[model samples]
Target: MTLSVHWRLDPAAEPRRSEPGAWQRLPALARDRRVSTQNRFDYFLQVAQAAAQTAFDGLFVRHRIEADESRIIAAIIARAVPHIHVVPEFPASVGSAVYAAKQATTFQRAAHDRLGWAIAPDAEPAGREAQADFVSDGDLAQRLDEFLTVARGVHRERPFSFKGSYFEVENGGFDAPLNRASFPRVYLQGSGDAALALSGRHADMHLFAPASTEALAKDIARLNALADGRSVAAGLIQPLLVRDERQTAERDARDRPLAPGTLVASYDEAAEILAGFAAIGITELVLEATPTLEEAYRIGQHLLPRLRALTSAARQAA
Candidate 1:
């Protein structure tokens, strides 16, 4: 099977020097402090295009609370990038699933045949309160289930209805022409039992967060079992650190202790690392090669070739 590879849109994974956060990194690019907004956008476009060239199947973009919207950015990306799929996280609780379905179709206009919907099923109590304008505290799990029902229902040729604890939709359907893939694939990221079970029943893919290798393995197994016979891609998000050789990788890891992250050593070592992940049933990898553009290019140029070469082999062996 072909392994699905994904990368992020955020060029600066670490907090910027002027930003308030635990760790800060200054930009090392040749550009000066007098960077214009358009210049910044162009820089990101450069990295994005590089990622596209490197053969990432998809791109993930995180949503900023009220400040920066992800849908607009995703649509723009869909237009710029040729065929790469874009999955932007939407807080499902923010709006009706019907709204999300229609919105997903509209967003697909730009990315047509290259869009997937990744939803944040719920938020912490404090965060939910802040979004009182959008969603409220309730059985978010049930809400998520209802959402999946409504979304899938609307995408079908026949009208669909649902009666549930949280949502009720009657004869709901979409008339707009769908992307080549029809409705965008739905994805969810969460580890709770409710999340896992619902994801098994609804999501085409389940996105995993950073965790120990062993932890991720166990979660993948549980999700696979929960999915029964249905096909669902299991994905992990990792930040990688790679080098030409094992010693170089080790030295870099030591030099940047805080950012050591996942060490992908030589091409052979990288293949072995990927093999291990595939052995544990990971079909998708969404990773950050580095926080800055330089590191992004370095990893993209170096490790990407190895990744592309060996992922399918590893999966076949598994």
Candidate 2:
């Protein structure tokens, strides 16, 4: 299978969108007068547009604690890049499943089949509990099961209700008939046995963070074995830094002022390393590029073609 690539977007962290005076400070926008509220938004849109024009198969927009990242950009990404899949990482507990399904369906109406979802079981993917005063330490696996069931149930376009440990719906369905394209492709990220089992049941893709090659191989095998024959795609999401020379990339990546644990190597080395992971079942890569837009364009314009060429050559030689 071909490699499926995805780019990450952090509305809260990228310099262009995060700095208070970023709009006036940007080289291109140095003289522009934009409102404070819309400044970050415009910058975010610009980066999103740049990403959409890249060779990436889709995007993975994170959901943060205070900021509703998914909601803030889901509509914009859908309309802006209606061709590629726009996947918003959503917290499983944020809203009721029925409501989420309806909301997603409404979004698909505007963007067609460009809709997809990634579920972060915790309020934060870092395993931090939500800030709610009433509820904490909820059953993540149970919530996921019920959430997916309800989310998929309503999309059948028939009035449906569900009774599960975490959710309840009564003859609930979308007001308008759901488009067949509204049934979203679901992706889940987890490393534990329980989480893998949960994903084996529902997720179309299982997103993994970078780990030692040996440990990751075992996890991949376990995930597939647990799936009981379900075809689940394996993926990785990691920081990417690529350049022409190995030494230059190493020196530059290790010295990057903004990030920790960055990948510093030529695109060829990165592709070769990734091919090892791919051999063990990882077929997708979600790259978190530093300096966001500028670096994203750098990779898209320069590294992607070279990486593809190297991989194709290696495949032919094999």
In order, candidate lDDTs are 0.70, 0.75
Model 1 over residues 159-180: C-alpha lDDT tens digits? 7788887678888777646523
**Candidate 2 per-residue C-alpha lDDT over 166-193 given as tens digits, one digit per residue, 9 for 90 to 100:** 8998887665556455577889998888
Please give the lDDT score for candidate 2. 0.75
Task: Name the 10 consecutive residues with the lowest summed lDDT in model 2.
Answer: 125-134
Taking the candidates one at a time, how many backbone clashes does each contain?
A: 0, 0
RMSD of each: 4.6, 3.3
* Model 1 residue 230 distance off true place after TM-score fit, in angstroms: 1.9
Provide the TM-score for each candidate, comma-separated: 0.81, 0.87
Best by TM-score: 2
Candidate 1 lDDT for residue 134: 41
